[model samples]
Target: MNLKFYTFAKNIVKIVLSPAFRVKTIGKENFPKDGGVLICANHIENLDPPIVGITCPRDIHFMAKEEIFHLPVLKDILPRVNAFPVKRGMSDREALRTGLSLLKEGKVLGLFPEGTRSKSGELGEGLAGAGFFALRTEAKIVPCAIIGPYKLFRPLKVIYGNPIDFTEYRAKKISADEATKIIMDEIRALLSAGK
Candidate 1:
């Protein structure tokens, strides 16, 4: 990843966003100091990824939709900032492999378990991809909630909950769906608290 570019982009984003929103972050202390971690967040808007990315203390490699990667300028910039494409509405095995590889290498992987943005601004049902990665690597899962009306000068909050451990589930070999539910439940709780 382009560390210098990532830092520069993050700073620019912070400056651009600071004037329009009262961005607040909570539970940053919950992030793991080392090792791979899966960050599962509820998707609400297009800016969600960068919002979480900047607020997060660790550098997050996010799995963005493949379509976005096709955009003109973003196509070139996204990859440099640790963003990768994942085909949606199908079983994109290559994306899965990339995510798993990052985790196994002790890198942070950010995913929107809902798969797509929530049009109603509410948390949606989570997909199994996140759970599968968590189970396979037994990586700590951090449930995040991004709450916003996104109005001018309005308050926008990103809350990170305590990390979830799947050691027991991995031992019992739980289904991916079940594991996803657990992760989603934590996200729901965070959203509830954020409001």
Candidate 2:
């Protein structure tokens, strides 16, 4: 998406959603202003990505679900806001390449480690693909906690934790699941913070 369009779209959506949802955000400074960074969070609802994106003053190249792309209006609107589709279950090399490309260009990539929305609003185990990105790239990984089911006119919170340092994990012989677990644990901690 072009910078001009993104800025306009972002501002318009923020204006509408912020007040309507009463979205509360903490740890906005957790996001690095310069260079590439990965924003990893638990999936609460389809709106989680936009909530996180607008809350943090950064342009996020979100790895969105493929099903949403099938939606007529959203399919077009989401990409305009820097969102790309990802086939959830199996590996989608195209999505991975797009994420890598965005990272290489020193852009922020937003993704959900859980790979799908949590129906019960509970945290669950993460998929290894999120770990794979963190382990392979030098980009910082920010664990974000999204609380609430994002009902209209309801309270929704997006709490961001400090970036997880994975330099050691990248150097070690850690399995994908182990690496995923390591990342997910931080997100879990963020969810439990100040509780």
Candidate 3:
């Protein structure tokens, strides 16, 4: 989709949903202006991507499920809305390449490290993909906390924490588990703050 069209669509969604969901954002300015940025949040709702995207200062290229693209309607609409497909729970090289390419262009990439939605709102252990991306791109990961259910007029809050840089571990032989722990600790702290 054209950049202008995407912006227009994003604004419309934000105008509509923000009020309905009673969405509130904190620490949005914590997102830096440039570089390959990663917005890492625990998934709580299926709408989390757009929920976070709407209030973001920069355009977010979210890593959506590959299955979504197979859907007749979303297949055409997702990419236009800045969502790229990724095979969940698999080492998808094609998706990796797509993610790296976008980051190389200095764009913000939205990732839900928890891999899937925590319907009960309890965060799960994060997948390794987020750590791998941080290692590969040397991107700053912004720990985000999204609190509250998606109910009509119920306040849902999204908090953006300070950026995390794992540059020190980039060239090191750190295990994915270790990287995940490091990343998740920051995320846990963010989540705890919202309580």
The prediction achieving the highest TM-score against the true structure is 1
Query: For each predicted model, how many residue pairs clash, with residues at least 3 apart or on different chains?
Result: 0, 0, 0
User: What shift in Å separates residue 115 of candidate 2 from its native position after superposition?
Assistant: 1.1
Over 22-86, each residue of candidate 2 has an lDDT whose tens digit, in order, gives: 98998988778888898889897777877887897788898888898989898778778888988
Question: Which stretches of candidate 2 lie above 4 Å from their native place?
Answer: none
What lDDT does each candidate get? 0.92, 0.85, 0.86
Candidate 1 least-lDDT 10 residues: 14-23
- Against the correct fold, how does model 1 do in TM-score? 0.97
TM-score of each: 0.97, 0.93, 0.95
2 or 3: which has the higher TM-score? Answer: 3
| Candidate 1 local distance difference test against the native | 0.92
Per-residue lDDT over 107-164 for candidate 1, one digit per residue giving the tens place of the 0 to 100 score: 9999999999999998889999988998999578999999997877999999999999
Report the lDDT tens digits of candidate 3 across residue range 1-195: 457767988999999999999999999889989988988898988888888989889999999988889999889878887888888878999988988888878888999988888867888998888887787786788888888788999999999999986877877868776787788888888879887
Local error of candidate 1 at residue 131 (angstroms)? 0.8
TM-score of 3: 0.95
Candidate 3 residue 36 C-alpha distance from true site, Å:
0.5
TM-score-superior candidate, 1 or 2:
1
Task: Select the stronger candidate by lDDT from 1 and 2.
Answer: 1
Candidate 3 pairs with clashing backbones: none
RMSD in order of candidates: 1.0, 1.5, 1.3
